[model samples]
Target chain A: MPNFFDLNVHAYPETDVPVEDMYRIAKRYGYTGIAITNHDDTEKGKEILPPSISTFVFRGVEIRTKSVSELKRKIKLHYGEVPLLAVHGGSEVINEAALKDSRVDILAHPCGEKGEGELSHVLVRYAAKNGVAIDFNLNAIIHSRRSDRARILWKMRENLKLVRKYKAPAIISSNARFIYDLRAPREMIALASLFGMKKDEAIHALSAIPEGVLEHKWKKKTEVEII
Target chain B: MKNAKCKVQKSKYQFVFYILHFALLLPPSLRERKRYLVFEVISEREIDKRELLEEIRDSIYSLYGDVGASESRIWLIDYDKKKDVGILRCAHNKVEEVRAALACIHSVNEARIGMRVIKIAGTIKGATRLIEKSV
Candidate 1:
């Protein structure tokens, strides 16, 4: 069976949730692994994490940059250090830069604040070619209500439809800062369906896509060691 | 006065018998199919059953609207106070809708809470069995 993984969990220094509690709640929610992505500047580098019972913990960095050159520099600096590197996508420049770069594993929330300019077919096609998975964050859904939540969901559905059409990879993450924000794999799957994703596709987004990223990172690490 | 009292007693006994007869007479297809969802809530403080149900209902209503909420026929089957585990009953077809709503619920009465669905079963008995094993 393919194990489920959440690739963008924030805890400890980045968020109020302690690392131990994040791991505990994630495991309880049936996640086989969790990638704790903290801001790059917050901590020096990937520090030693506490031992988990069975859940595999992976270190990741969320890069927030202004210009293309800055984003590129951050990616090159952190690519070898962390198993996952996600770009915080809200600005048009950042979204384009992140999609075109193969080093960035995920473009976190492309439609977050940028309305219609969030993503286009050309951008999504480039993402497909570069193997950058667009993120569908669950935090917006969990935290918002009324008109705000509806707007977020509507924008996400548009992104989801385009991503599916372009045959680009899509991944779902809780992007949870608090333990309460975490959800079970099955629950995540159900929520994805509301945004035009199929059941099987949602399952793949949670498990297979993130697992592929992990495997790719593992290969890179081993190859470097051998050389 | 005596005759009136006897009639009232007979009518009460007849009402009970009538309800039992109708309940037995209902067709299997007419009965609502139920699905039990087992879940655990992790939060700062203990959550009461009343608040949990209200929050769940509100979420369902917000996401799916009033019609979907009514169609869901959501019910709290049972909850363990200390363990913070509960079994929720809903219409069979509305299980996914209910699950989605439950997943989106992050807080109850301003207290942050995390809910994890343990198992989903077609019967309350099966759901309870899964809960015992997991707990």
Candidate 2:
């Protein structure tokens, strides 16, 4: 089995559940590792990694901001501080800004948590060039029903098309706040299928792409050193 | 003559029993192929079997609609409330579709829950064995 990683999970200060609880459950669910990417606004000061579980629980930040300039500053602030830098994407402007910057890692929920954002081919091409992986948060699909779920699936389908055309890296994350929100990797692949993602593509998104993102495989050497 | 009559009567009864068996149970070739999925659930509190089954059905209906739900042919074969694990059966070709529906269910009767399929098998016996090994 390939090593599966969930790069956008929230825990501790973001919610009531602690990192240890999330790590234990994620390990039980068969994940190779999980990144605790609490929202920057909610996080209190610098997060100290619990030494015991540090190997499997990666510390990351999900920058949630409105203005483009502030987003840029935050990216500059957190770039090399953490192993993963996820931008909470929504709105046309934020999507474009995040994708354009090569420093940004994964763009979590490009369509917004509620399926409110949009991405065009140009933005996707930028993501391709910048090596910013577009995240498809399956929680949106799992939580919504009826028309809301339909809309999210439709938006994801459109985004998937763009990602495919540009050959941009894509990742599927639970984006789970609580332990109950997590799903097994196979279930994630099945959920991805709901939005037109093929089996192989979903597997790659859940495993290979996230691993590459962790290793900064697509990042330029100079960009890495400058941080 | 008596032995021959007894043997003939026994043969006739055997033939009738075979016909009845075929009539009551579909022949293997004609039977619909099914897969058994052994799954585990983690929830806020104990969930009743009926409630969980209802939620599963509702999820399938809402996600796939009537026609698609019918094609899946979902059925709950066994559930151990204490263990929070169960065996569900569905059409062989519809496993993935059913899996998606199962994943869509985030709650049951207001109790938040998460579910995952542990293993899938072609027979209930195989699924049960998997459940044993996993537990």
TM-scores of the candidates in the order shown: 0.87, 0.92
Put down candidate 2 lDDT per residue, A28-71, tens digits, no spaces: 98999999999999877565677988989988899999999999
For model 1, name the residue pairs that clash: none
How much is B78 displaced in model 2, in angstroms? Answer: 0.9
- Which residue segments of model 1 deviate by more than 4 Å? A44-46, A51-55, A113-117, A217-227, B1-25
A1-227 in candidate 1: lDDT tens per residue? 67999999887877666778888877777789999888776765345586653347788889976788988989999988877889988888889989988778888888774333378888999888777889998887877888878888888988888888888888999888888888989989889887778899999999998998777742355357669
Residue range B47-129, candidate 1, lDDT tens digits:
99999999998999999899989999999989897989999999989888888899888888889987877788998789989
| DockQ, model 2, C-alpha based | 0.80
**TM-score, chain B only, every model?**
0.80, 0.85
Task: Give the range where candidate 2 chain B is weakest over 10 consecutive residues by summed lDDT.
Answer: B19-28
DockQ of each: 0.74, 0.80
Please tell me how candidate 2 rates in CAPRI terms.
high
